[model samples]
Target: MAIWVCRAGKKAVYVEEFLKQEKIFCTWDGFDYDLNLYDDKEKLKEKIRKEKKDAEPTAINTWAAQLMCLKEKMQNGDIVLTPNENSKSYNIGIIIGVYEYKSEVPEHFRHGRQVRWLPDIIFRDKMPQYMIYSLGAYRTIFNLKYENEFVELLAKLGIPI
Candidate 1:
């Protein structure tokens, strides 16, 4: 399974909410429609530019790519790693459901996927330097570059990989 790093929110603002709800979400306010409806990232980008006229070209591109990754690239059974700044720990889980538009939730959190979290929490202090570096990515969502090493580390920790 592919592994991904998905942040709850800047500074882990939505960490507790995500853990409580058993889901992972990304915020792109006003674009609440199902991402599956879009034929490709370019279409989504066009829509974003149309709706958010003030957004910069770079921001628009980033949002479109990230949203597409969340909706299309990610799949059921993929491993998800979410960092919790409050606890200085990383929460691991498996994506158990497909992309969904949860209009019932707050506007920023409308896009999400259900997750089944593992009971264990890996503290930052205990992680390797490479892992720390990789997880320090600026984007909201990204695939792990060192997937095999990460899986090996998890196996060593007695976590089911």
Candidate 2:
């Protein structure tokens, strides 16, 4: 299963709230369009480029790539790690459904994917240094592909692999 690191909010203002609610995760609020509407990531990127003309190429790419992840790459069994800013812990969850566009949510968080937040929380200090580095990436969404490292993490949390 793939692992994804998602921040609850840019400033982490909604980490606890999100964990409490156990809803979906959203990113790139500026796009404003429902990412679920597009099937092709390239097409989405093109649209982003046209709409956000002044945005840097890197910014546009990051947004499109992450939107694509939410739309397609993340599967039902995939894990998600959303760091808890109030503590040195992560709010872990498993994706349970496909992409969803909730217009009722605040404008910044319209594109989402349902997640079943795991009951246990993992503290950063308990994880290995290498895994910690991977989790420290600045990107909003990424593939955490270190198999052994993840195994270690799950084991530490008493979660069966």
Candidate with maximal lDDT: 1
**After superposition, which runs of candidate 2 have C-alpha atoms over 4 Å from their true positions?**
none
* Model 1, position 147: C-alpha lDDT score: 82
Off by over 4 Å in 1: none
lDDT of each: 0.86, 0.78
lDDT of 2 by residue, 19-121 (tens): 6666656755566777767879788989999999998989888888988888889899888888877438887788888888877777756777778887888
* Native-to-model Cα distance after best TM-score fit, residue 115 in candidate 2, in Å: 1.0
Backbone clash pairs for candidate 2 read none
Evaluated at residue 9, the lDDT of candidate 1 is: 81
For the record, the alpha-carbon RMSD of candidate 1 to the native fold, in angstroms, is: 1.5
Question: Best candidate per TM-score, number?
Answer: 1
lDDT per residue, candidate 1, 120-153, as tens digits? 8778777788888888888988888888888888
State candidate 2's TM-score: 0.89
